[model samples]
Structure formats: structure tokens, C-alpha cells
Target: MSQETVNYLVNLLIGVILAGVLSQYWRLEASGQSLRLWIIAAWTLAAADLFFVARSMLPPDTLPRLIPTITVTCGHALLLLAAQQTAQRPQQRRVICLIVASHLLLLLLLRAVPAMQGWRAPTNSVVWGSLSLAAALVLWRAADHVRPLMRFPAMVMAFQAFFHATRSLLATQAAVDANPVRSAAVQMLGDVEVSLFMVALFVGVLVAYLRQSNDDLRRALANVQQLSSMLPLCAWCNKVRDDDGYWRRIEEYLSEHKVSVTHSMCESCATKHFDEFKP
Candidate 1:
């Protein structure tokens, strides 16, 4: 029932999911490289959660608390990167770096001024919310063939974006009023929401990957069928050309390709080859 216990469970679940995702990445072919970014993002979030659970034990200073904030911000950024890769969009690396740099600068400024400590939560929320929204939009607006595969993950991202935005507003109010109970309540809600979102988003992404892989397999099979139908045959010899550019009897080619054939002569061929039939 305690928030701390809840956070511990959530973190443990994230760790398990992260491990499973990494194993999946390993089992997949090279095409699953996009999952690398997601793994990193999940790791970043796990680090943040670890810091969050241990925040009470940390020294009473802005620097110590900023660790979680920084990690969480980076985690969102990496998620956006993963989304872009999934959608097969050109990654705006420079823009992403600039945004991160600006956020770090803002954090430094906040740290310099003790009076502005309250704004940290809102600032972090804004960055996270914006990044989540961007990722959702990217997936939603992807190419038609890719849109269906990404739709669920996009929806999850959109929901998280809205959650973070609303949380940001609550954080602003809490900062302004210095309300401990409201702040604690917001934190609890955020922990639960984030845990749910992570589980859903990753599951959605894994499903999307499966769909994409299946589509690719179907297309490959279709191509193979088309190619098989169009095999090159000699005009005079009736021999078929195999993949190695060697021509062989049609029967041989068919047999090599695992096709079963039965020997049968047409009436015309039978009559032409027999003198009695010709009469």
C-alpha cells in the first residue's frame, strides 16, 4: 500500500521486461537493431527509478535529486529516438541534442538559484510530456504501411503525453502552494501511471515488431512465388535455368526445386510419334 513499495515493484517489473526485451533483440535478426535504442531508454528509466526510490537516503541537495530528473529526461529522449527509428524516419540528431542541452542548461540555472527549486518538477514534466507527444505524432503520421503496426504504441505514447502534461500542471500548483500532501499524491499517481505506461508501451512495440516481421515474411514469400512462376526456359530444349545460371531439363529443374511430377503423354504427341495413330 505504501508508495515506496509500489515503486520497488514497478522497478522490478521494468527490470524483468528489460531483460526479456534484450533477449528478444538477441534472438531477432539484424533488422531488430532499432530495439537497441529502446533497451537503452528502458535502462535509463530504470536508473531514474532506482534513484527515485533512494532519494530519501540521498543528501538534502539539488544535485542529488537532479540525478533522477536528468536520467528521466534522457530516457524520454531515447524513446523518441526509438520511435523515429521504428517509423523509419530520418533521425533529427542535432535537434535532439540541442533540446537536451537546453534542458541541462535550464537545470543548471535552477540549481544555481535555491528559490527556483520548486520549478524543477514542472520543467522535467514539460520536457518528458513534449518528447512523448512528439514520439506519438511521429508514429501516427508514419507511412501507411507502417502506421498500422505502430498504432498501438502511438496511442500509448499519446496517453502518456497527456498524463505527463496534466501532471505538470499539478506540479506547478504544488510548487506554487508548497502543498506537501498534493505533491505526495502527485508523485504516487505518477509512479503508477509511468509503470503502467512502460509495460503497455513495450508490449505494444513488441507486437508491432512481430507484425512487421510477419508482413516482411509474407512479402518475401510472394516474391519467391512470382520468381518461381517466371523461371527461364530454353525455347528449343525446354530446359529451365536455375539460380546458378545452369540450364537443365524442365523435369530436372522441377525435381530440384522439390516439385513432384508424373510422366504423361498428350494425345497429339502420342499420335505424332506412332505410325498407326498417324493413319
Candidate 2:
């Protein structure tokens, strides 16, 4: 309820968002499709949270929970899509999209439920709990099929989601209709929840994306640098005839493939070409 606490949490969230962005740099050359999308979702959530925090600064009227409800819920869906992409199951991508769309409708209808407006106290904890559990299950499934490095990020996010679901259930059930202290605690938990969850997922996925990019880059560079070895020939004449019938200078052949060469006569070549000459 204190201004200092609110400012501190919001600032922390901002820091998390920046850390996530920095992590993306590492994926510069990777197949960053999924990673990029997830970071965008996180930054979007952070932006919305910032906006909510700003609105809360105005007055003590009923805190507008709608923006955050949409932001966080949609952000979670985006996170799931990203996780699925990283796991390389594009075939199941449409299923994930359908799930997201269904949730959007559910969340939209939540506005009619007066008690749901303030998540600090859940009038019906079971509904939210079940939904959160299902999302976690989906994330777990995605993790099951992902690569090792990506698996960690997915697991980290799943853990974050689990905690968030627990926090929601606890905060809601403890004070849905009763104590002020419990309500305040619920409010405090809600205040910090989005920030915490977004940071974990964002940081993990960004690091994974950047790493993927780096791997892709290294592979590409290796491909570019690869050359078929030429047959060993007399280094004296500078001719590099391969197993093939064609005879050509090694430097000339390499040049055709965008590889530059510097001319240098080796000791053997020097000795053979100028047998009687002094250095």
C-alpha cells in the first residue's frame, strides 16, 4: 500500500525487461523466431504493467484490473507459443493458438464477475486454479519435447507459472470475503506477481534464443569456410591438381570460391626453382 513499495516493484520489473532484451543479443544469428516472439510478449506485459502502475498513482478508486488481466493472460499464451516453437512442434502450433483464443474469450467474460475484478480476493479460486494448472500442464508438455538448453528455460517458466498459480490461490482464498490484512497481502502479492513471472520467462527464453542464433551462426560460418582438400602435389611448381583430371594453381582455384590467397614460395619451391641462386 506504500508508494515506495509500488515504485520499487515497478522498477524491478523494468530492470527485468531490460535484462531480457540484453539476452536477445546473444541469439543474433540463431533461428530466433520463437525467442523473439516471447521477448516481445514480455516487453508488452512490462509496458502494460507500467501503465497500470501509472494509473494506480492517480487516486484510490477501484484499481483498474482489466488491462493487467488481459496483458498477463495474453502474455502467457504468447509464452506458450514461444515454448512450443522452441520445442520444434510447429504441427501442434495451431492447437496452442486455439487454446489461447479460448482463454481470451474466458478472460473477456471475467469482467461480468464483480468479485473477479480484484484478484486480490478470488470469489472463486477453483476456476482460476484449474485454468492455471492447465496452462502449466501445457508448458510441461512443451518442455518434455524441447532440447536440453531450451528445456531449462521452459522448466524455469513452468516453475514461475506454478508459483503464480499458488500465489493467486492463496491470496484469493485467504481473504475473499473476510480480513483486511489478508486482503492487503493479496493485493501486495498481486502487485508483484506479474513482475516476477514475466522476468523469469523473459530472461530464460531470451537467453535460449540468442544461444540458438550463435549456434546457427557458427554452423553457417563453418559451411562457408569448408573446402574440399586438393591432392598433395609438388609444392615447388605451385600447381594443385586434385584427384580429378583438371590441373590448376591452388591459389587460382581457391580464389574462384571467394577465398583470397597470398603468394609465398616455400623453401622447397625456392630451392627447386633457383637451385644455384644465393638468398
Candidate 3:
């Protein structure tokens, strides 16, 4: 098969794998809101890649080109949302909406103005690059404890930003149509890069999620340790049962567990012990 066909197959495979894995995790409730966005983004990305695979078969029309571009851009936006949520950052929904609207407007303008058609590829590249940069910045500025875990994904985003910016420079209308060899090489390189980015992103997000789970587990253990009221105690003997089912005096149990014990008498106990005890 031709190199282009091979690249298309590879992209299709990557997209399907990512979408399937993310969906499975989503069903499992592996995370929360952030993960839900991630799953959606993964599916969006898969759709974009599918379009890329089918573009060669489809007629050379604006709709075919426009569809994948919009799909991928939307996918990037979803990824950005996921990153913002993961970082516990304020999601500027209005700002994101405005940005997406502006991008769509630009695309619409290109479609309406024949003279501006040549600028479509560059415009899309700029938007994708900007979104990648935004995701990188969000990951970099996440909470200190999770920042280290996020750095790998941030770096991946940064690399993708550079790739998109470079692509924008190379994919001008004249350049694309004039030189078939150079364009093919660029396309091949891009497919490889995108696949790498997708896989790296999956790994990075999975690691971050695992870290979050570990943090949650640690917090839960701390809370469990602090909760002593749930312990089984015998009212008559005033003894507490240990985990091993051995009963011991309350003071002895608390002392054995390294808990400080204090002596206090409730009003009822005091009143029963001393007739002069007041409320």
C-alpha cells in the first residue's frame, strides 16, 4: 500500500484505541467531571482522525475539509476543559465560548470570501496551536502536589503547539498544491506526531488520575484513623474492643493506641455521684 494509506490506517487505529479505552474508563467512573470531558474529547479526536482517513476518498470540497478542522478544534477545546477541571482552575466558559465562536466565524468568513480560502489551513493551525498552548499552561500551573505529575502532559501539549505552529507555516495554499513530495513528508510527519501526542496524553492523564486516587486514599485513611467513635464498646464493662476483638478498659485501649486520655464527668454522672452537683 501507499505511504498515505498506511498513515491513514495508523491514525484510524490510534483514534479507535484511544476512544475505546477512554470510554471504558468513563463507564467505570474512574474519575469525575474531568474524566467525562476527556472521554468526550477522545471521541471527538477519533472522529477527526476518521475524517482524515476518509478525506482522500471524498470529493475535494470545502465541507470535507471544514468538517475535520472543526472536529479537531472542538476536541482540543474539550481537552482544555478537561485540563482546567483537573487543575482545579476556574473554567472560563464564556471565554471559551467566545473563542470557539470566533474560530467558527473565521471559518465562515473563509467560506464566504473566495480570496480568503487560501488562508483556511493557516487559520486552523493557529487556532489549534493556541488551544494546545492554553492546555499546556493550565497543566503547568496546576496545584503543587499534582504539578509534577502534570508536567509530562504539559510538555506534550507544548510540543503539539510547536508542531501546529510549524504546520501552519508549511501548509500555505501554493505550497500545498505546488510541491507534492514536501507536502506528503509533512503530512506523514504530522500523522506520526499526532499519534505520539495522543498516546502520551493518555499515559499522562492516567498517571495523574492514579496520583489523585492515591491522594484520596491517603485522606480516607487519615479520616478513618481519626474516627474513634465508631469503635465497639461494652456499656456495662466500659471496655472497648480492639480490631483483634480483645476488650480492654477505655483508658488502656486509648493509651495502647497512643491516644491521649482525659478524665471528665458528664452532668448526669456528677449529679448521680454528688447530690450538690448543679446543672
Candidate 4:
């Protein structure tokens, strides 16, 4: 297969796998709903990439190119939403809507004015880079609220922003007669870099989630242990005394604590209550 084909396959696989993993966690209590937005972003970008690979097969038109731009912009917007949610910040819905609308307007302008086609690449690069940088900033500012391991995803976002910006600058410098071999090599390298970055992002997010989940579990276990250790029970009634100094049945206390209690008489209790019926 051609290098471009290989790149397409690699990116497609990465996107699918990441989306699938996020979907699996979607239903889990510990995986928070924010991840679902991130999954949507991943899928959107993946679909855009797929379109990019198939661009040659599609009719050469403004719409074909515009579709990818729109999808990519939407994906980045979703990423911003995910980051905001992850940091427990108020989602600025108006700002997000404005961003999307502005991008769409710019895209429409580009489509209408053939003279401005040359500016499309740089403009898109700026938009993508800015969104990534914003996400990184959000992650950095919210560090205290998230696990320390979340720094990995933040760093990845920062690097991606830098790469996109640099690529845009480099594209502007390339001569019309640039060496085909060098251009091809650079393009291949960029694809590989992007694929690797996406993989890193997936792993980083997964690790952050797992670490947070583990910490939560540890805290919950500790609370349970502490509760078990200090529980006060009445010797005669077998009722438990809560912190409020109220005496409650053991089952009632457990139930109030969000623990499920099933009623069943123990073997000893059964034998004591009905000695002749003991099996």
C-alpha cells in the first residue's frame, strides 16, 4: 500500500479503538459523562481524517473540502467541552456556540471567494492549534481538581498545538517547486506524529480515569473500614448507635448508609428460635 493509505489505516484504527474504549466506559459509574463528549470528538476527527484520505476519490469541489473543515472544527469544540467538564468548570455554552458559528462563517467565506482559497490551510491550522492550546490551558488551570496523571493529556495537547502551528508556518515557506520527495517524506512524518499523538492522548486519558477511579475506591474502602471498626452495637437489642446518638436496627443503619441489606435468619438464630425444627 501507498504511504498515504497506510497512514489512513493507522489513523482509522486508532480512532475506532479509542472510541470503542470510551464507549465501554460510558456506562460505568466511575467513567463520568464527560468522557462521552471526548469520545464524540474522537469519532468526529476520525471521520474527518477518513474524508481527507478519500478526497482524491471525491469530486473536486468546495463542499468536499468544507466538510472536513466543519467536522474538524466541531471535534475541537467538543474537546473543549470535554476539558471544561473534566475540570468541573461551568461550560460556556454561548462561547462554544459562537466559536462554531464563527468558524462556519469563515468557511462559507472561503467557499464563496475563490481568491481566498490559498488562505484556507493557514486559517484552519490556526483554528486547530488555538483550540488545542485552549484545551491545554484549561487542563493546566484545573490541575488541582484532577489527578496528577492528567498532566500527560495536557502536555499532549500542548505539543499538538505547537506542531500544528509549526506546520502551518512551514507550509507558508514551501516553494511552489519544492522537492516532491522531501514533501512526501514530511507529509508521512506528520501523519505518523499525529497518529502517535492520538494514541498517547487515548492512553493518557485512560490512565487518568483509572487512577481517579482507584483513588475513589480506596477512599470508599477506607470509609467502610472506619465505619466497621467504630460501630457501636447494643448487646441486647443488637441495634447500632449512629453518630446522631440514635439507636437503629443494623439493617436500617446499613440501608441508610446506601448499603443493601437482605433479611435472613442465621443458623444459630434459627436453632435457638426452633430447637426441634433444626436440620
- Residue by residue across 22-138, what tens digits does model 4's lDDT show? 777766654544677778888887887787677646666547667767787888888888888887777777897788889889988887887665556557777888888998888
Q: How do these models rank on TM-score, best leading?
A: 1, 4, 3, 2
Top candidate by lDDT: 1
Clashes of 3: 0
Per-residue CA lDDT of model 2 for 87-123, tens digit only, reads 5545355665676566556655655665554552352
Q: List the residue pairs that clash in candidate 4.
A: none
Model 3 stretches astray by more than 4 angstroms = 29-33, 112-118, 172-180, 222-279
By lDDT, is 1 or 2 better? 1
What's model 4's TM-score?
Answer: 0.75
- Candidate achieving higher lDDT, 1 or 4: 1
Cα RMSD (angstroms) for every candidate in the order listed:
10.3, 10.2, 7.6, 7.2
Candidate ranking under lDDT, highest first, comes to 1, 3, 4, 2
Candidate 1 residue lDDT tens string, 117-203? 788878888998999999999999888888998899999999999998999999999999999888888878887787788788887
**Which of 2 and 3 is the better model by lDDT?**
3
State each model's CA lDDT, in order.
Answer: 0.81, 0.57, 0.80, 0.77
Model 1: lDDT equals: 0.81
**Candidate 4 global CA lDDT score:** 0.77
Q: What's the C-alpha lDDT at position 1 in model 2?
A: 74
User: Better model by TM-score, 1 or 2?
Assistant: 1
- The local lDDT score (0 to 100) that residue 279 gets in candidate 4 is 66
Provide the lDDT at 178 for model 4: 51
**Clash totals, every prediction:** 0, 4, 0, 0
